[model samples]
Target: MSCPICGAEQQTKYRPFCSKRCSDLDLAKWLNGSYAIPAEAAAEEEEWNEADRSSTEPRH
Candidate 1:
């Protein structure tokens, strides 16, 4: 198989990526949100916000 990042032949150690550099590059993309799965907007955004606000408010 070829590397997904650089199209080089995949190494045995890195089956999907040819080298550690390519593997780390892919990880960085994920960590930085360069790759994302599509999602529909939540139908209850207001309710969710209210719950979050209530949780953070001081109890008194």
Candidate 2:
């Protein structure tokens, strides 16, 4: 299999990563919030955006 970080061949120990460096890089990304699961905003936030948008839109 190939490493997700650098696209190199994966090592047995690292499995999906090529080396400790690549594996650590992945972990760092997670720790620093670079890798994240997408989610929708909360109801209140959505409502706020709706009100904001309405105020900015030009009248028909």
Candidate 3:
């Protein structure tokens, strides 16, 4: 298999990445939001509104 980050041959320790550097780079990309799963804004907005309402409500 090849590295997803650099297209180099994948190493045993890093099956999807060639080395620690590539692995770290991929992690950084994820942490910085370079990659994302698409979401529908309408659904997300509804969820957010529900969460906000619940948070503001008095608890028993």
Candidate 4:
């Protein structure tokens, strides 16, 4: 099959990518939020907001 990253023919070890370089590139994209979707669920947003608030607020 063709590699999704570079459109090259995929190697046997990297079925969806051409080689280790393409695979690492895809992983870097994922880790840096390049592939993220906008807006999570309301509950998740609420949770994130709570965490942010806690981090910024002073201890009692």
Candidate 5:
């Protein structure tokens, strides 16, 4: 199998990735929201906004 990130041959240690650098790069993508699905993220954001608005309203 080949590395998904760089297309290099897969290494035994990394399994799917060729090296630590590529593995770390993939992780950084996740940590920084590079892998976020747009529809899900938008729904989550809308939920947060609605919650914030409800919290700020004066109580009856």
Candidate 6:
């Protein structure tokens, strides 16, 4: 398999990535939201319901 970030042949040490740099690059992309999927408007309603449910639950 090749590195998704640089197309280098994947090394056993890096598994899906070819090197530590590529792995870090991939992580940076996620941290910077470069890999984020666009949220649908309906997701907000679901998030609000989840928050309400959590707030109503008693903490142990």
Q: Model 4 over residues 1-60: C-alpha lDDT tens digits?
A: 899999999999987899999999999999998997767598898999999999999998
Candidate 1 global lDDT: 0.92
Ranking the candidates on lDDT from highest down gives: 3, 2, 5, 6, 1, 4
Error at 35, model 1, angstroms: 0.9
Residue 55 of model 5 has an lDDT of: 100
Worst 10 residues of 1 by lDDT: 38-47
Q: Please, what is the whole-model Cα lDDT of each candidate in the order they appear?
A: 0.92, 0.94, 0.94, 0.92, 0.93, 0.93
TM-score of candidate 3 on Cα atoms, chains taken together: 0.67
Winner by lDDT between candidate 4 and candidate 3: 3
Best by lDDT: 3
| lDDT by residue for model 1 (1-60), tens | 899999999999987899999999999999999999976556577779889999999999
Kindly indicate the candidate among 2 and 4 with the higher TM-score.
2
- Please report how far candidate 1 places residue 55 from its true position, in Å: 18
User: What is candidate 3's CA lDDT for residue 23?
Assistant: 97
Model 3 gets an lDDT of 0.94
Tens digits of per-residue lDDT for model 5, 17-47: 9999999999999999899765668789999
Worst 10 residues of 6 by lDDT: 36-45
Give the lDDT of residue 28 in candidate 5.
96
For candidate 5, what is the TM-score?
0.63
Model 4: CA > 4 A from native = 40-60
